[model samples]
Target: MQDFLFYFLSALTLISGLMVPVSKNPVNGAMYMILCLIGTAGLFALLGSYFMAALQVLVYAGAIMVLFIFIIMLINAPAETKRKRDIPSLIAAAIAFLMLTVGFVMMAMSPELNQPMPALEDAETLAAEGAIPFDGSAKSYGFGLYGKYMLPIQVMGFLLLAAMVGVIHLSKDLHARSQAMLKVKENASE
Candidate 1:
C-alpha cells in the first residue's frame, strides 16, 4: 500500500514538475509548481519524514510559491505566442520523451523501491541517540533554526532586503526612462 502510494505521488510530482517548466503562462506554471511541491511533501510523509513534509508544504508551497505568484501578477507576463512546430523544438520534445520513458523503466526494475520500511521502536531512544532527534515537530524546528541556525537566518534576511532594494532601484530607473521619452515626444509636438 505504501509502495503504491509512493509511486503514485512520485508520478504526480514528476508530471506537475514538467508542467511547471513547459507551461507558457506564468500563472499556470506557478500553480503547477505548487502542486509539484505538495506531491513531494506527500512522498516525504509516506517515507515517515513528517518534518520534511511540513517544511515542503510551509516553505516551498506556502512562502515561495506565493511569492512567485505575486511577482508574476505584478509583472503581468505577455500572452504566449503561437509558433509553428519547428524542427528544433520537436527534436527537444522527442529527447525529453525518450528520457522520461527510460526513467520509468529504471524505476520499474528497482524492487527495493517498492519495499516497506521497518517499524519504529523507541521514540526516546531514537532521540537520545540522535537518530530522530528533536521530536520532529514544527516547534522543535523553530527552536533549532533560532538557536543553531541564527547566523544563517540573519544572512537570509539581509539577502532578501538587498533583493528588494535592487528591484525598487530597477523599477525607478525604468520609470525615469519612460518619463524622459514622454517629455521628448511632447517637445517634438511643440
Candidate 2:
C-alpha cells in the first residue's frame, strides 16, 4: 500500500511540476504550482512527516500561492518587456541559488539529519499506537519558528510589504507613462 501510494504521489508531483513550466498563462502556471505543492505534501505525509506535509499545503499552496497570484494580478504586468522580465528573473534566480545554498547548509546542520534510527522500544510503541509519532511535527516547527527564526521571518514579512509598495508605485508610473504617450500621440494628430 505504501509503495503504491509513494508511486502515485511521485507521478502526481512530476506531472504537475511539468505543467507548471509548460502552462503559458502565468495564472495557470501558478495554479499548477499549487497542484505540484499538494503532491509534494502527499509525499511528505507518506514519509510520516505529517506536520511538514501540512505546512507544505498551508504555507506554500495556501499563503504563498495567494501572494503570488495577488502580485501577478496587481502587476497585470506589461507584455514581457525584455528589460523588465530578464533583469528581474536573473536577479531572482541568483538570489534563489544563494538562498538554496544557505538552506542546504542549514539542513546539514540540523540535529535531526544526523539522528540514528529509532530504538526498538520506540518502534514497538509506535506500532502499538498504530500511528507514526508526532515527534517530527508541529511542536518542533512552532518552536523553531518562534525561537531562532522569528527575526528572520519578521524581516521577510517586512520585505514583502516593501515589495508590494514598490509594485504599486511601479504600476502608477506605468499608467502615467501610458497616459503621457497617449497625449503625445493626440497632439501629433492635431
Candidate 3:
C-alpha cells in the first residue's frame, strides 16, 4: 500500500513538474506547479513528515503560488506572440533543444540520480522492521518552530509583509505611469 501510494504520488509529481514548463501559458504553468507541489506534499506525508507536508502545502502551494498568480495577472501579460518561422533560427533552436535533451538524459542516467536518499531509506527501514514512531504533528510542529525556529519565522513573516507593501506601492505607480504613457502616445498619434 505504501509503495503503491509512493509510486502514484511520484508519477503525479513528475507529470505536473513537466507540465509547468510544457504549458504554453505562464498562468497554466503556475497552476501546474501548484499541482506538483501538492504531489510533493503527499509524498512527504507518506514519509511520515506531516509538518513538512503542511509546510509544503501552506508555503509553496498556498503563499508562493498566490504570489505567482498575482504577478502573472498584475502586468496583464499577453500570451507569447507567435514569430515567423525563420529557417536559420528554427535550425538553431532545434540544435539547442537537442543538446539540452541529451544533457538531461545523461544526467538522468547518472549514478547520482540512481542513488537512494538516506532519509527515505531510514524511514523505509524503520517501517519495515518495527513501528514507525509518530513524532510529527501540529503541536510538535509549533513547539519545534517556536522553540528553535522562532526568530527565522518572524523574520520571514516581516519580509513577506514588506514585499506585499512594496508590490502594492509599485503597482499603483506603474498604473499611473502606463496611463500617462498611453495619453502621450494618443496625443502624438493625433
C-alpha TM-score for every candidate: 0.65, 0.53, 0.62
Q: Over all chains combined, what TM-score does candidate 3 have?
A: 0.62
The candidate, 1 or 3, that scores higher on TM-score is 1
Provide the RMSD of all predictions against the true structure, rounded to 1 decimal. 4.9, 9.5, 7.0
Clashing pairs in 1: none
- Top model by lDDT, which number? 3
Q: What does candidate 1's lDDT look like per residue over 1-190, in tens digits?
A: 9779989999999999999868889899999999999999998888666899988999999998999999989888687778675889879988998999999989977998776544555455545553435355677777878987899999999999999999888867787899999999999999
Model 2, position 82: C-alpha lDDT score: 43
> Could you say which candidate leads in TM-score?
1
lDDT over C-alpha atoms for residue 173 of model 2: 72
| lDDT, model 2 | 0.83
Clashing pairs in 3: none
Give me the overall lDDT of model 1: 0.85
Q: Rate the local accuracy (lDDT) of all candidates.
A: 0.85, 0.83, 0.85
Compared with the true structure, what per-residue lDDT tens digits does model 2 show for residues 1-190?
9789989999989888978866667888899899999999999888777898998999999999999999899889665444445678778988996899899989988998877546544753656454443455688667767876899989999999999999888768787899999999999999
The superposed Cα distance between candidate 3 and the true structure at residue 36, in angstroms, equals 0.6
Worst 10 residues of 2 by lDDT: 127-136
Worst 10 residues of 3 by lDDT: 124-133
Error of 3 at 136 (Å): 1.6
* True-structure lDDT of candidate 3: 0.85
Name the TM-score of candidate 2. 0.53
